[model samples]
Target: MQRIRLDAAAAANAEDAEVWRWFSGLLEERRVRWRYMFSRWVVNVDRVHVATEQNFYDAIRMAKEAATRRGLGLSTIGCSRIR
Candidate 1:
């Protein structure tokens, strides 16, 4: 029910700045925070990563890698920009 800033890394780089937008919400369990987001819709269901690393950089990297592994590539233009 609340929004929070969990990333403190500098956003000097364009990619770093873009990382913020891909993030949607936080899911917590056992006092731990996890990044949550909706993947590009595919088939009847979208494949999502619910337990990605909590750190922004790590989360982004993991997402990119996972997408690549699944044959769902994320392009430069696909990166989200912070509002």
Candidate 2:
């Protein structure tokens, strides 16, 4: 499995004061690898999402499976559909 990374460092420079402050909450930097069941693909990422910390492994598996089963690409897991 290959590891992928999703860095949110761009949030550090967020124009909105509230957004920038919120980004500050991500004090830790990390990454995780997710295996795709139906393909040779994997997702590596890092962020401050609660679901990521609590059920990241499962979430990735579900996302990968969902994409593969539906014959879609990474973009298939849209930002609004991740939950």
Candidate 3:
């Protein structure tokens, strides 16, 4: 699995007020290893979202599994693949 990383301090200066990130590693059912760690600038809060998935469907599947194990659930799931 290849880990994709983005270093904020190394990024070039930009005038955009908001920065957004979008990621898609598999085009036809493959693995995507993702790692994320979030920290608040002025508050004591941390968040993380990471998973190694075989495809878009697998990502949703894994999330559902995790939720289910914790007695939680999801309302909906969506995809934008043109098949």
Candidate 4:
């Protein structure tokens, strides 16, 4: 049982590391900014941004999707634009 738990933990850590790497690459490639504030994940791309519940991976994914949609000239329904 202990070994099983340890393996699970290791897997989770590996997944987290992978996510962090991807996020870092995204920052370099897209000039994106991110922060955790008010118990939420806030991601910004130029004038547009998104805030999501504190799930780190989901928040980043949503932000990326929003940025892509905006870049493609699609509506960003859940994102806000800085004025």
Q: What TM-score, computed on C-alpha atoms, does each candidate reach?
A: 0.32, 0.24, 0.26, 0.50
C-alpha lDDT (0 to 100) for residue 14 of candidate 3: 35
**Per-residue lDDT of model 4, residues 1-83, tens digit only:** 99999999999999777656556665656656777889888877664675475877788767666766677223344568799
The model with the greatest lDDT is 4
Candidate 3 displacement at residue 67 in angstroms: 0.9
Error of 4 at 61 (Å): 0.5
Predicted structure 1, TM vs. truth: 0.32
With candidate 2 superimposed using the best TM-score fit, by how many Å does residue 3's alpha carbon deviate from the native?
28
Model 2 weakest lDDT span, ten residues long: 20-29
| Model 3 Cα RMSD, 1 decimal | 15.6
Q: Give the per-residue lDDT of model 3 (tens digit) for 1-83.
A: 12323444334323121111112212122222333224211101012233335554444445434444544332222656567
lDDT of 2 at 83: 60
TM-score head-to-head 2 vs 3, winner: 3
**N/CA/C clash count, model 4:** 0
Off by over 4 Å in 3: 1-51, 74-83
- Mind giving the per-residue lDDT tens digits that candidate 2 earns over 1-83? 12222234444334344332322332122233444444333444342222222353445544444444544333322256546
What TM-score does candidate 4 get on C-alpha atoms?
0.50
As a whole number from 0 to 100, the lDDT of residue 27 in candidate 4 is: 62
Model 1 residue 52 CA deviation (Å) reads 0.9
| Tens digits of per-residue lDDT for model 1, 1-83 | 12223232333455655544443211111211333445422211024542255455575556655555765433335457788
Ranking by lDDT: 4, 1, 2, 3
Which structure among the candidates has the greatest TM-score?
A: 4
